[model samples]
Each structure stands twice: as C-alpha cells, then as structure tokens.
Target chain A: MQHEREHTLKAFDQDLDRLRALISEMGGLAEHAIGEAMRCLVERDVAGARRIVQDDKKLDALEIETERRVVQLIALRAPMAGDLRDSVAALKISGVVERIGDYAKNIARRVPELQDVGHLEPLSLLPEMARIATHMVHDVLDAFVNRDAEAAVKVAERDQALDDFYDSIFRTLLTFMMEKPNNISHATQLLFVAKNLERVGDHATNIAEMVYYAATGGQMTERLEKAGAL
Target chain B: MQHEREHTLKAFDQDLDRLRALISEMGGLAEHAIGEAMRCLVERDVAGARRIVQDDKKLDALEIETERRVVQLIALRAPMAGDLRDSVAALKISGVVERIGDYAKNIARRVPELQDVGHLEPLSLLPEMARIATHMVHDVLDAFVNRDAEAAVKVAERDQALDDFYDSIFRTLLTFMMEKPNNISHATQLLFVAKNLERVGDHATNIAEMVYYAATGGQMTERLEKAGAL
Candidate 1:
C-alpha cells in the first residue's frame, strides 16, 4: 500500500510538470508573437506578420491541450487544496494566454494597413510598450511555475507603466490624427494596437492574480484595490 | 449505497442549478450595462455612466462567488466526465462574462469623453449594435442554462452581423474624421466604442462555444473554421 501510494504521488507530480510545461510553451509563443508582431509593424514585414498570425494556431492548440491535461489531472489525481487550485489556475491562465496570443494576432493583422504610416511618431513608442507588456507575460508565467506569490504581486504592479504608456500614446495619436486628418484611418489602427498592448498587460496581471491565488490560497482583492489606487 | 448514490446525484444537480443561476445573474447585469452605456452615450448622461461603472463591481463580486462555488462543487462532488466538464465550463464562462462586463464598463468610461460629440451620425447605429450584442449575451446564457447546443450555435452565428456593423461604422467614422479634424478626438472614442461592441459579440460567441462544448463534449474548431470562412 505504501509503495502504491508513492507510485501514484510520483505520477501526479509528473502530470503537473507536464501541465506547467505546456503552459510555459504557450507563454513563450505568445511572448514571441508580440515581439514579432511589433517588429513586423516597424519594418512593414507583412510576411512576418502573417507568420505570427499563423503561429497563433499553435498557441491555441496548446491551450486546448492544457485544458485536456487539467481535466485528466483532476479526474485521475483528485488534487486537494493548493494542488487543486493550481490546476484550476493553470486552466484559467491557459485561456488568458490564448487571448494574449489573439491580441498579438490582431496586432499582426494591422501591420499591412500601416505600411505607409510606419514612420508615425507614436509608432516609435509601441516597441517599448510591447517590450514591457511582453516582460509582464514572461514574469507572470515564471511566478506561476515557481508558485511565487510575491513575484506574482510584483508582476501585477508593472501594469501601471503599461497603462501610462497607453495613455501617452493615446494622446499622441489623437494629436497626430487631429493635425493630419489624412492619417486618421492608419492612426486609428495604431490606437487599437496600443489598446491591444494595454489589454495584454491587463491579461498578464490577471494571470498574476491567478498565480498569487493559487500559491497563497487567498484572494488578491486587496492587491487589486491597491493597484487601482495607484 | 444506492440511496447514497441518489442523494449525491441530487446534491450535484442542485449545485449545478446554483452555478447556472449565478451565471445568469452575471449575464443579465452585463447585458443591462451594455444597453445603459449606449443610452448614456446618446443621452449624455454622465451620472448614469458612472452608475454603470459602480455596478460593475457587483458583477465582479458575483464572478468571484461563482468561482468559489465551482471550486467547492469540484472538490466535494469529485464529478466525473460530463459533470466535471460542466464545472470547468462554468469556471471559464464566469471569467468570460466578467470580461464582457468590463467591456461594458469600458464603454461607460468613454461616455463622459463623448459629451461634446454626442450628436455624431455614427452614434445612431451604436444603440442598435448594442441591442443585438445584448441579446446575444442574453440568449447565450439561456443556452448555457438549458444546455442547448443548437441555440448556442445560433448565438455564435449572430456575431457576423456585429462585425458588419463595426465595419460600416469604421468607414463612416473615418470619413467623418477626415472631413472635420476637430471630430477626430471624439470620433476615436466612437471607434473604440464600436470595437468594444464588436468584442462583446466575440465574447458572447466565446461563451456559446463553451456552452456547446459542455453540452456535446466536442470542440468547436470546425464551426470556427466555418465562421472564419464567413
């Protein structure tokens, strides 16, 4: 009986490790997609943007695989307490990551539209904004893997910078549009790209909250309130 | 043992009923918020917009409650197969509905921004767009409660109309902005409002997919492909 118990425990651990690996793979793809989409925007590389859109399918597949693994883990292992919560978090985070990938895809789709407007001033701010948003995705997934509630909180805090960047870009683009009405359509695309990046930041923070909850078994309502105050 | 099995089944059904009720409440709040936000936009009712923002917290609270109940249902019942899938679907749908509520709040936030440009021509189309989106939310939640996969599919199909509405508004607003640079600032707000409505449609479709999956235990990839073709 003792040996049997040990064997089951080892299998459950392996299953969890696989789940985390799938999530990490999905996160890496989403992060890469963001960078590539922004790069494509800057360089007017429509082919690369197309590739990013195609690559989103892989992330989608991984999210579905993650859900399958999570379901199997719960049914087979019946993980208790923190483990169970972690499994649930994994499920939710995979969905969020997939949406992050969609945002990247959305940004990619706009690349061809901005071929002429690539030199716009607000365009320059976007790569940096994308960099920050991508980092949040990276850091939050790391927190999830390590079950580090503190790191998760830190990641959640970084969203403010992204929000500030979005606000600045919004103002900059509005001015650009007002000054040059001909640029309205393309500038509008950039506005959405900025909004998409802002939403990516928000989604990362959401995953951070889930990670914190899974690790600490407490609601992050206070942290959210604090962040709101910021 | 049979009596105990029957008792367990009864409790599980009651738990599911509660889960469905919570989701319905969240859905209703989200749908109502969409309508009110659009009304506030047309009427220039900043106070009503603020009220929509404040009321979003209640939806958020309900989502958290739904999550808690789902966790309990999973842990205590240890549901198998379809029941387990339903529990997981409820978890995901709650998150999606919460986001739908956030989109409504986002629309409301812009209500104050558009105070000066309330009479814009494109503004007329928005209330109808919002109406359709709200109906989608209402119908999809009904599908979830009834486990009606066909109804869910119908709800998903309606998203195309929302997309069409968005496209027309996008063109109209671009022309309006180019004709009057002063309108760019407010026109941009309307663009985002249209985008928000489009996303609400997408989210309602997302919930419909979840409902379909929970009911049929099949992926919606084929339907997605068909929709993409559309």
Candidate 2:
C-alpha cells in the first residue's frame, strides 16, 4: 500500500509538470505572436503581419489543449490546496494569454491599412509600448512558473507605465487627427493599436493577480489598489 | 461507506449550485451597469454615470468572492467531468462579466465629456447598441443557468448585429469628424463609447462559448466562425 501511494504521488507530480510545461509553451507562442505583430507593424511588412494572424490559431489550439489537460489532471489527481490553485491559475492564464495573442493579431490586421499612410509622429511610441507590454507578459509568466508573488506584484506595477504611455499616445493621436481630416483614418487605427497594447498590459496585470493568489492564497486587492494608486 | 459517498455527493451539488447563484448575481449587476451607463449617456445624467462607475466596485468584489469560492470548491470536492466544467465555466464567466462591467464604467466616464459637446448624430446609436449588448449578456447568463447550448449559440449569433451597429456608428462618426474640425474631440469620445459597447458584445459572446462548452463538452469553433462570417 505504501508503494502504491508513492507511485500515485509521482504520477500526480508528473501531471502537474506537464501542465506547467504546456502553459510555458503557450506563453512562448503568445509572446512571439506579439513580437512578430509589432515587427510587422514597424517594418511595414504586410506578409509578416499575415503570418502572425495565421499563427494565432496555434495559440488557440494550445489553449484548448491546456484546458483539457487541466480538467484531466483535476479528475485524475484530485489536487488539493496549493495544487488546486496552480491548476486553476494555469487554466485562467491560458485564456488571458490567448487573448493577448488575439490583440496581437488585431494589431497585425491594421498593418495593411496603415501601409498607404505616411508615417506620423505618434507612430514612434508604438514599439516602446509594445515592448513594455510584451515584457510584462514574459515576466508575469515567469512569476507564475516560479511562484513568485513579489515578481508578480512588480509586474502589476509596470502596468502604470504602460497606462502613461497610452495617455501620451492618445493625446498625440488626437492632435494628429485634429490637425487634418485626412489623418483621421490612420490616426484612428493607430489609436486602436495603442488601445490594444494597453489592453495587453491589462491582461498581463490580470495574470499577475492570478499568480499572486495562486502562490499566496491571499487576495491581491490591496496590493493592486496600491499599484493603481502609483 | 455508501451513505458517506451519497452525502458527499449532495454537498458537491450544493457547492456547484452556490457557484451558479453567485455568477447569476454578478451577471445581473453587469447587465444593469451597461443599461445605466447608456441611460446616463443618452440623458446627459452625470450623476447617473457616476453611479454606474461606483456600482462597478460591487461587480469587482463579487468576482473576487466567486474566484475564492471556485478555488475552495475545487480543492474540497475535486469534482469530475461535468461538475468540473461547470465550476470552471463559472470561474471564466465571472471574469468576463467583470470585464463587461468595466466597459460600462468606461462608457460612463465619457458621459461628462459628452455633456459639453451637445447632441451629435452618431450619439443616437449608442443607446440602441447598448440595449442589444445588454440583452446578449442577459440571454447568455440565462443560457448558462439553463445549460441551454442552443440558446447560447443564439446569443453568439446576435453579436453580429452589434458588430454591424458598431460599423455604422464608426462610419458616421468618422464623417462627422471630417466634416468639422470642432467635431473631432466629441466624435472621438462617441467612437470610444461605441467601441466599448461593441466590446461588451464580444465579452457576452465569449461567455456564450464557455456556456456551450460546459453544456455539451464540444467546442463552438464552427458556430463562432459562422457568426463572424455573418
């Protein structure tokens, strides 16, 4: 009976490792999707943008697969306490990562439309904002993997910088639109791209909150409020 | 042993039912938030808009409570197959509903900005679009409660109409911005309001997908694609 219990415990560990590996894989794909989408945007590479759009399907498939694995692990292993939180957090974060991928694809779709328009001053901010957003995605997933609540809190704090970037971009784009009617369409598309990046930052923050809760079993309400205040 | 098993099962059912009730409560709050935000926008009721913003905190608190209950239920009960799906679906839907409430608050935040702009042509569509989106939230939550996959699919299909309304509003607002430079700022705010309503529709559709999966254990990829094609 002792040996049998040990074997079952080992199998449970393997199941959890597998779930973590799957989420890490999904995270890598989502991060690449965001990078490629931004590259396509800055380089004016329409084909590259199309590729990111196509690649989003892989992230979608991975999300479904991750959800399946989570359900299977719960049913077979019946994880408790911390294990249960880890499994549920993985499930929730997969959805958020998939959403970040969608935003990347949405940004890519706007690339072709912007190709004909002359470069505007606010376009310079796109790469920086995208960089910050992608970095947040990376660091937050790392925090999840490491079970580091402090790292996750730091990631949540970074979102404020992204928010500031968005405000600046919004003001700049509005000026561009107001200056000339012809700039309206391009400016509006850029506005959406900025908004998408802001949303990606928000998703990253969401993941950070989940990671904190998964690691500590304590709500991050006060911490998040503090971050927001900052 | 058999008696113990039956008691445990009964408790599991009660837990699931409790989670469902919490979700329904949250959904009602979100739907009301959207409606009140729209009413505030149409009536130029800054106080009403402020109320919607304040009410969003309740949705946020409910989401945190829902997540905690979901984690506790999974840890204690270790539900399998259908029960597991129901719990996770409740978890996912709570996040979506919370986001919908946030969007309503975002729309409300713009009301004061719009109050100074006087009436605009595209502003008329905001209430109608909001109505459709809120109705989708109501129906999708109903579908969740009933385990009605067909009704969820129907709700998903309705998103196309919201998309259409958004497109019409987008074009009209763009025209208004182009026709008069002074209209740019207010029209832009209206554009964002329309975008928020459209996003609420998207969140409602996402809930419908989760409901369909929870009910049928089958993906709604084809149905979603069909809706998008329309």
Give per-residue lDDT, candidate 1, residue B185.
84
In candidate 1, stretches whose alpha carbon ends up further than 4 angstroms from where it belongs are A1-8, A116-118, A221-230, B116-118, B223-230
**C-alpha RMSD over true interface residues, each candidate:** 1.8, 2.3
lDDT of each prediction vs. the true structure?
A: 0.90, 0.88
Best by TM-score: 1
Q: TM-scores of the first chain across all predictions?
A: 0.95, 0.95
lDDT of 2 by residue, A1-230 (tens): 99998898898878877877888888898888888888888778999999999999999999989987887777667777888888889988998999999999999999998887676778888988998999999999999989999999989889989999999999888888888779898889889899999999999999999999999988777766776753
Best-performing candidate as measured by DockQ: 1
lDDT of 2 at B194: 89
Looking at model 2, residue B108 earns an lDDT score of: 91
Clash pairs for candidate 2: none
Q: In model 2 chain A, where is the ten-residue run with the lowest total lDDT? A: A221-230
Clashing pairs in 1: none
Lowest lDDT sum, 10 consecutive residues, model 2 chain B, at: B221-230
Per-residue lDDT tens digits for candidate 1, residues A105-209, read 999999989876536877899999999999999999999999999899999888998999899999999999888887888889999999999999999999998
